[model samples]
Target: MTAAATTHQHTNCLRCGRKLTSTKSTATGYGPTCTRKVKAAAKAEIVATYKPHLVAKAEELIEQGGIVALRGRNVFQVVASNGVDTYKAARQGCTCAAGLKGKHVCYHRIAAHILSLAA
Candidate 1:
C-alpha cells in the first residue's frame, strides 16, 4: 500500500505523548511509531491472555452438546465439532492487511472472540 506523502496531522502521541510529526515511519491516525508497536503488543498480550480461557470454555460447551453459531463482517466460516456438539461461525469481512489491517481488530476475530466468551 502506498502511504500518503503528507502524514495525517495529530496533536500528540495518545499513548506516550511522543511527537509523531517528526518521525518518518508512523502508523497513521495514531500517536508515535513506537507507541503503535506498544499498543499492538499490549493488545496482542491481552488477547493471548484471554485465549486460553476462551478456548477452554468453548471446548467445555462443545463437550456438553452445545452448539453456537456466530456471524461477523468478513464472511469466513469456522467450525468446531466434537462428536455430538458443534459450533460454527461465519464472518463477513476481511481483516487482513489487504483489507483493514491497520484497524487491528477484525470482524472475524471479534465474532470468534464473542463466541468463545459465550461458550
Candidate 2:
C-alpha cells in the first residue's frame, strides 16, 4: 500500500491509544468510554477546586451588570448591584465584610475572578 493509504488505514483512540473498533469511534478518534471519562475528568477538575457559592455569585454578577476594574497590581474593584455597592477585590482576599473575616469567598472576589477569566 502507498504511504498515505497505510497512514489512513490505522485509526487509534486519542485518549487510550487503542485501535479504533467501531465506525463512530474511528470518526471521533475516541472510544465512547474514554470520551465519557475525559468529559467527567474535565468537569470534576473545574468544579472540585472552586466554591459553588462563589461560582453562583459570579454568574449573578454577570447577569446584574457588575463592573470589574483594576485598581493596581493584584488589586481589583467590583461595582455590583447596579452600582449600589463597590467592593475591593484583591489576590489575598476581598475588602467586603465577609471576605475580611476569611469566612467565605465573597461575591466581589468572585466577580473579579470571572472578569479576569473573560479577559
Q: Report, for every candidate in turn, its global Cα lDDT versus the true structure.
A: 0.37, 0.56
lDDT of 2: 0.56
**Model 2 weakest lDDT span, ten residues long:** 1-10
For each candidate, give its TM-score against the true structure. Answer: 0.24, 0.48
Q: Candidate 2 clashing pairs?
A: none
Task: State residue 62's C-alpha deviation in candidate 2, in Å.
Answer: 2.4
CA lDDT, candidate 2, residue 20: 80
Off by over 4 Å in 1: 1-8, 23-33, 36-40, 51-119
- Give a tens-digit lDDT track for model 2, residues 1-119: 23432233327654345798887666555567765663454344434656877666665553333433455324565664445567778646887788889987776766555444333
